[model samples]
Target: MRKLLTLKHWKNTFAFIYKLLMSKEVAVRDKLLFLIPVIVYWVVPDVLPLIPIDDIAFTMIIAEWFAARMGRKYNIS
Candidate 1:
């Protein structure tokens, strides 16, 4: 546990989070990656209605797709 607190470990952690955040796969198919949100939304309708949930989800999918395409097109070496 102590080893995990080192600068190296923190750097690795940061890098992993950065990659996950930037990843379109995660952004779009994150449901596949993490189903916690889905379960929560289903279990608690008052928190997020089905219609609003669908709207937010579909919007994220489209946005992630567009971002992924643009990233690929403008990828730099």
Candidate 2:
């Protein structure tokens, strides 16, 4: 568990994320959905009156979905 906290672990994780996002098998809508929460948080003006909580929650859900989908498709644990 402690080994995963190193920079190498993070680099590998990001590499996997990039591969997953760039895969041809993933639909454009799914890619767009993955970017939605991230874009919303950064483009703050459009999300007024609402706290960032919605964006955070959506991001978490999408991240979990993305991880599971990628793991299944790539046959990775």
Candidate 3:
């Protein structure tokens, strides 16, 4: 129906927004700080439990990589 098409369009729009959010120019520290609240919000609700540990770790790794790429290395030791 007409509503389905509109919903699909919105889904793509959100996907694009998410991609832009995770884009390279966002900075690593900023990503972690941003993702912290996002992850917390997604996890604390006990909803969207589909997020896996590996995926979460991978996201952090990517953020750390971006941080290093931006010349802002983090020493967790």
Candidate 4:
């Protein structure tokens, strides 16, 4: 978990996310799998009002998960 807290790790995570999103090899459906939930959450945070997580924090967490999952699935570095 030490890696998760580093600025470099997050930078790499965001970079990977950008690469995956932009790559034409990745299907639109796959891209939407990452984007839809994030957009929905940001637009409707009150859907889970009890949870106190900020919008950006939620996006970052989903981004990290999406990067790792897509990287493995797509054989992306």
Winning model by lDDT: 4
- At residue 53, candidate 1 shows an lDDT of 50
Q: Could you arrange the candidates by lDDT from highest to lowest?
A: 4, 2, 3, 1
lDDT of 4 by residue, 26-51 (tens): 99999999999999989887666766
Candidate 3 per-residue lDDT, tens place, 19-67, comes to 5456676656665764676567556547665655555455444444444
How high is each candidate's TM-score?
A: 0.35, 0.54, 0.34, 0.88
Highest-TM-score candidate: 4
List per-prediction Cα lDDT, in the order shown.
Answer: 0.49, 0.65, 0.51, 0.92
lDDT of 2 at 64: 61
The C-alpha stretches of model 2 lying farther than 4 A from their native spots are: 1-4, 45-65, 73-77
How are the candidates ranked when ordered by TM-score, highest leading?
Answer: 4, 2, 1, 3
At residue 32, candidate 3 shows an lDDT of 71
- As for candidate 4, its clashing pairs are none
lDDT of model 1 at residue 44? 70
User: Between 2 and 4, whose lDDT is larger?
Assistant: 4
- Better structure of 1 and 3 per TM-score: 1
Q: Give the per-residue lDDT digits (tens) of candidate 1, residues 1-77.
A: 67544768555544544465466655445423334554455567666565555644543444345445444644511
What is candidate 4's TM-score against the reference?
0.88
Off by over 4 Å in 4: 46-50
Model 2 scores a C-alpha lDDT of: 0.65
